[model samples]
Target: METILDKIIAKKREDIRNMTELTINDLDLSREKRSFIEKLRHTSEMAIISEFKRASPSKGIINANLNPAEQGALYESYGASAISVLTDVYFKGTFEDLKTVREAVNLPILCKDFMVERKQISHAKAAGADLILLIAAVHGKDALKELHEYAAELGLEVLVEIHDDEELEKAVSIGAELIGINNRNLKTFEVNLGTTEKLGPLVRQSGAFLISESGMKTREDVVRAAKAGANGILVGETFMSADNLKQTFRDFKVPLTVPQR
Candidate 1:
């Protein structure tokens, strides 16, 4: 029986291969030469990178209009640490999202996509991205290492995502200081906060800026994750589903204040 991670990884390898075939004349990253992503100097200050995502493999019709720049502007306005933009075209997203967001927000913009090859590294630079998310399940150990290194050399930050304890090892091995724990199971599309609960300790061991991703729907979940040692939360559905994203971030800042006992 294959896990969700297994299937997504296989799918990414094929998706990336096809995307590379596109010959582009518009993008230009000619003067880019910095390893911003891998540079340990720039630490993830403030909160988790708020993701301006449109849809996912599991959930459909998340947000069609998804104005990436508008969302980024909102997240930045509310004092978010970074903005994550989904760039997988098949997933109803595009690199244009990151480009637009990067232009609007002052914070770092994470290129959240099904990354498998180096083509995306160049895409990040050309599109004005500050960070990139590399899913460990979709990349072999060697490939993950190489990709992280490559992204680092370009002055970009890398957020290595892991679904389980086993994958955490791979993330650390590749020197992934910024880590994202996804709760949604890739194969069955099931979600359980326990995934983050279980992996929290492992990530803490490595001292990475840990973020809990997927299945995050409520402010209570955010507070719970913080208790479990999570530094930030990468959310999409809850925030994206809103009509006013800036208000959503403002709402998130309260973190469900409890009544006095």
Candidate 2:
């Protein structure tokens, strides 16, 4: 019995395979893809790429009408390093979500979707996406390598997401500059913050920028991740699901008291 994740991923793979009929090489490239990569490279601050995720498998709809654009604008105003928009429609997001963030903020907007082929690349590029995520677990090494090269050619920065060593090695081998270490096992949706603490260093050693994803609910988690050499943190559920989203995000930055040193 294939789970919802399995079904969605399979359908996506088929869509990508079907995309061959359109002749990917002949498809025109959008200018926004190149511009988006420029903005991300310029935001040198070590800050959160705050995500506006509506729902997740572990928790039901957190905010059905949260208005991603408005929320993203607010996040940018509050000093978010960047914005993350989930473009997986079945999981509570779409290209519109990416556009919403794009229109509302000057900060970079990363399209958090299961990108399989180049067609979606043009879609995301046209929709105002500044960056695109390419999950290593979903694609074979060859496919990821091809997509990564294509994305670079399109002028989009690729966030190569890896869950473990196998994928991490592949990500490094492909010369990915941005590495996202996802703590959640998409196969079972089980999260272990330790994954970030565990693999982040090895990824950094390979020369890619590092980020910690999932299982982060508190400032301690942020500090722990930062100590692990994470260049940035991608936070969504804890902030968006809180009763007071603004305050929850703010609390992560409250200064810790120290005995007179």
Candidate 3:
């Protein structure tokens, strides 16, 4: 059976083929690199990498009228440690959105997309992205390693996303320091915070910066993740649909030292 992730990857390959060459000169590489790891490492509170997501494969058309630049700035003002811009067309996003956000904020920017090619890393670096996502489920161990190294070569950090222990081991084998445990399963789109609870400790034990991604809606949810040993949380729909972005961001910024019950 073809999953949503399979369909997205298929479309992405076609998009890459049709993509026009984006030379380094064509992009504004003048922006200084903001370190995503450094920002998270130094923060006393649970770091929040707020996302500028227009939609998702499961949830469609979330705040379609949102201006990426404005949203990015708002996230910064609300104490976001970094800004993540979804750069996949399947998610109703584009690289233009990442660029716009880059121009508007100085926070570390994550280009959230299914990265399979080195050229995509080049595009991400040129667009002023500080980090790029590499999904372990989408790439073989060797491919994942190659992309992780390639991103490093371009001075961009890799947020290796893993779904299970096998994928986590693959990320660990690649010496991935930044790992995002996505709670929403890409295959079924079913979200369970327990995904983080189950995998977060292994990541923490491996001495990697653990980021819990997706399905974070409330303060309790954030607390739950923090207790699971997440150094940071990647929140999208909650922030995008928020009537009060500042409060919502603040509410979700639980202390990393949150006491376990």
Quote each prediction's TM-score: 0.82, 0.85, 0.95
Worst 10 residues of 2 by lDDT: 252-261
Predicted candidate 1 versus true structure: per-residue lDDT over 2-92, tens digit per residue: 7755766677677677654322344443544334333223443315568787887777778898577777777777767677888875468
Error (Å) of candidate 1 at residue 186 is 1.4
Deviating ranges (above 4 Å) for candidate 3: 21-31, 258-261
TM-score of 3: 0.95
For lDDT, candidate 1 versus 2, the one ahead is 2
Location of the lowest summed lDDT over 10 successive residues in candidate 1: 252-261
Against the true structure, whose TM-score is highest?
Answer: 3
lDDT of 1 at 221: 74
lDDT of 3 by residue, 75-189 (tens): 9998999999999998899889998999899899999998878889889888779999999999999999998997887778999999999999999999999999999999999
In candidate 3 the C-alpha lDDT for residue 85 amounts to 96
Ordered list by lDDT, greatest first:
3, 2, 1
Relative to the true structure, candidate 2 reaches a TM of: 0.85
| Residues 187-231 of candidate 2: C-alpha lDDT, one tens digit per residue | 888989899889977987887778789888887887777767677
State the local distance difference test value for candidate 2.
0.77
Better of 2 and 3 by lDDT: 3
- Candidate 1 runs further than 4 Å off: 1-46, 243-247, 254-261
Question: Ranking under TM-score, best-scoring first?
Answer: 3, 2, 1
lDDT scores of the candidates, listed in order: 0.72, 0.77, 0.90
Model 3 clash pairs are: none
